[model samples]
Target: MDATTMADAILAALGGAGNVRGVTHCATRVRVDPAESARVDVTALARIPGVLAAQVVGDRVQIVVGPGRVEAVSGAVRRGAGSATAPAHRGRLSARTVGVLVDVFTPLLPAFVAGGLLTALHNVLAGPGVFGDTAVIDTLTWLRGPVALVGLVGAAVFALLPVLLGFSAAGRFGGSPYLGAAMGAALVAAPGLTADSALPAIHLTPETGWVIAGVDVLAIDYQGTVVPIIAICFVLARLERFFARRTSGSARLLLVPLLTLLTTGLLAFLVLGPALRFLGDAAAQGMEWLYTGAGVLGGALVGAVYSPLVVTGLHQGLIAIELGLLSTGGSFIFPIAAAANVAQAAASLAVWLCARRGTRLRALAATATAPAALGIAEPAMFGVTLRLRVPFLIAVGATAVSAALLAAWRVEAVTLGAAGLLGFASIAPGSVGPFLACLAVSMLLSFGGTLAWARWRRRRGRPIDGEDPRRSGDETAILSPVAGRRVAVESLADQAFAASALGPTAAVAPESGLITAPVAGTVSAVAATAHAYGITTDGGTEVLVHIGIDTVRLNGDGFRPLVRAGDRVAAGDPLARADLDAIVAAELDPVVLTIVTEAGARTFAPIDGETRVVAGTPVLGPVGSPENI
Candidate 1:
């Protein structure tokens, strides 16, 4: 469906734009911070044909659609917010560029985790005399070999991610990605040291280093490294285009790229590289001061803020924090970070435990939890916790608790990369036991906390089986025609006449029916196409019931109408008889719905799966609630 239609539907379902506090999305889901989470119709959201899932996290409610849904969802969200209040658009990259980020990060998550874990394990296996026995050594040889192989491969990709990003960004910026990536590769390959050398070997060694401009620039290996080269490559692509208009062919290529490489590479080796290294060291020192000066407070804050860092993709920059803790035995950030990572999964587990039965919320929570346990919270933070409230808070609480314990234990780490629970290996051997204990405590706190809260809310907020307390005298009842799972009552798609079917959206069939009123109301508007009608129920609930998309073209020719605008229809009174064959012949789906048009009414959802329904049965709302607002 077009964004406008979706937005209109959401606005109607939400009762009005005023009910929404704000809305946003990260990579995949639409997050809505509602004025009242209780007012949201979970059942109606689930029934939205375009929506996959709906959940609440903290103060925000998230709607999960798939990839590429962001733009449409964003548009819809903006429209839902209001046509007049256009928010600033963001993201340094376009949809396609962001898409590449998702692709690169998601598919490679498992490999990155496995590589980190195996490398850590290899370190353990080769320690002291554990594998000194001939049989053990022989058996583990192949394991380390493969581990090394995979680790190297994974490391290469992670290191070169910037290059991949550059390539993708180049395409978005209207340059050739292939050529741009090639340019980046060229700089990395320029007169580097031997394959085994940790540092690149220049034509002149340090003893014989040649001067560039005035300063001596040393050659350094770029392989399996993150530096400024990728940034320079993009700059070169733009320079190439700019110079191409003035200069021709190879000269444009040679001068621009060559000049870019020489300038950037030299500056990196002579300036930026040392600067970054110094900055990293400085950051390490600051982390040390925090650990030493503030003690547990620092750790708690770090843990609390880590998940949000990951959200902005700036978490990778925290490598210095972990390295600092590793280099200085005085800190606990590494162990605490690891524990917090695991805590996210623990929180998800809590959410799963507390979710109502048969909502599919549990299944999604389970999927996100596994990745979190492995030190990859993207799937969890972005997929699940971002959606569910209890889970997010549980993670935060766990992180704080775990970090405090880690600080108290004075846990220290020595290795790099995210290894979650197994990151325990990186901790100083003497501190391992304490770190593990902290992790366990964190996980328990997270799980128990979330479960406790979710259970309390669920029990306390149980809806009445037959009616809503918010609706009392003069409240109208919008009943379901067919007894089935309640779907969304939203706006109609502009491309389809049913945009007003469910309300502003079309209601999905829980079963078959000759659509009728769920509430007795007056007809507000009738489509000239004769496929749909708008009604204002006696209780002042405005509603729309559309037969199908483009069915207006059929012009009652295929539909038998029982009522028109201004007609007073009672609950269960048939409004139209649909010609099953003509509808099929017209190349349209036969789904029909009765929608609430007026704002501010109470809404309810179906119990579970499609249930046997009937006209006059309670379907959506009892009226005079947020659904009608």
Candidate 2:
């Protein structure tokens, strides 16, 4: 689906744009903080095309749309929801804090990825011993200038990272981005409060720098620091808002920037900067100590939980720590992430191999494997492995072993890149061999482990991938819920239903406004919007009767439920009444869908041919079964 349409469908599923409190996206998921979590229709979300998965972690609804598409869809959602301002703090303090951090750094990924690749290139071309005893730059003297230029361009982002953080943080915190950038520039600017200042007889150091109320303020460079800049920009945002509120007109514009900058800058140099810089440093050192001191155990722990962290949206917070580690020397986290990603890909591939040909599971696994191998593992993780249950566990176990091996070999990445097979390019040249070795082990172990499990299941007479364990009971026929002209499921405009992602389905263009029970059983569910209903048959068939496409947005305007949950109803009994004209007037399709959402032990064979039908007619039944005319 197009981004705009996807965004609209997501909003409608999320209870419309008015219900979205805040929205943001990471690499593969659009994280939405809803004004009312209870209002979110997870079923509808899962039915949206291109949505790999829809889940609720804490107070946020994370819709996984895979890697390449998340940014555009998220941008569309953000615009539609009007959530360009700072995300409202709605969940746990830690979750909200992480959301804010994600907002600040997500926009910088392109720069990080580009810089990382370039730096890796420079390492190959100029770093000693990368090519025999001498580097490519040394072997070819004429290439020196271009190689030097590459190194400079590659290092620029990290060198000026604080400034970038300043601009993003300030904008996120609701302040002028330019002023925040200026603050960042001041932190990295040389000759200002340094020991060897240009101004003669004016030197600064821990021992000789200006004393602030008996405390000596040390002059420190904040070039690649993360915490300090983020903290300072937040303060800057507050100061700007404070100044702007008290001043008016021309004076407001003039005084706000001037006063906010001076006040915040002083606070940064004397208090916030020094204090937060220490905190940032400690965090970096703590991570280093964990990896170095704890050795293999630490790496295993990180690798095992990396995918889970991604699931909960906590992994985005690790970017700051990764950046910190990069500044210090190298990041061990990236190598472990690479191993974990490769493991997932391998497990997905294993599942595809075990799955029956032409089955949905095999197709999904086949499509997800390549992307997972490319470092975008959400499709494999969410769409394939996690759904199967066992493959996800196998992948995690394999990742732990591989990460432990990497730690034993002291392998690390110098910069960020694809955290899968292509990650070798980003590994420190000397550590590249170990990284590749661990990655190979991860792939082999994950693939073998999953395939072994599938074989065990087959030996036990259990289904490997195509069979649903929930399937039970005998086959039954499903009655049409509306009197209308029959329509084929595959011919519908809604791709999710057409693809049978929600199970076997048939649609009808309604000839009447009255909707009826499709099965003789209890009313399982009644949508608050009155546009949909669910009925569980006596034989245990789960059926969903949807009145119209995108009719949830009507908010019960022209729909009324005649039955409530737990009410026993016979086939053809009134379930609801929908205004077909109202649905069409709202620019939505007025097709009624009768879906065998779950057909336990029975394959749904929708009636062939597009013919007019009446409510209560048998429209779907087991293969070769006579229609109940």
Query: How accurate locally, in lDDT, is each candidate?
Result: 0.55, 0.75
Off by over 4 Å in 2: 1-88, 190-219, 288-295, 301-401, 407-435, 442-629
**Per-residue lDDT of model 1, residues 409-434, tens digit only:** 67777665454765665667688788
Clashing pairs in 2: none
Q: lDDT winner among the candidates?
A: 2
What lDDT score goes with residue 244 in model 2? 72
Q: Compared with the true structure, what per-residue lDDT tens digits does model 2 show for residues 1-629?
A: 99989999999999999999887664345779999999999999989998877877668788877444766898789878978743232223543454466557656655654565565566667765445666678889999999899878867877787788789989988899999899988788643545565655666653555666544444455666666778899999989977876788999978999999999988988888777655544544554566778888977876787776654333545677889888988988889888988888999999999887766568768867865675766567656676655788899999989989998998888877667777776788789888889999999999999999988876754445434323222435677888889887788765555666566677889998999877666577665456777777657887888877656556667886766555546666678888889999998888998877667777787876449888867788776677522
lDDT of 1 at 540: 56
> lDDT (0-100) at residue 34 of candidate 1?
74
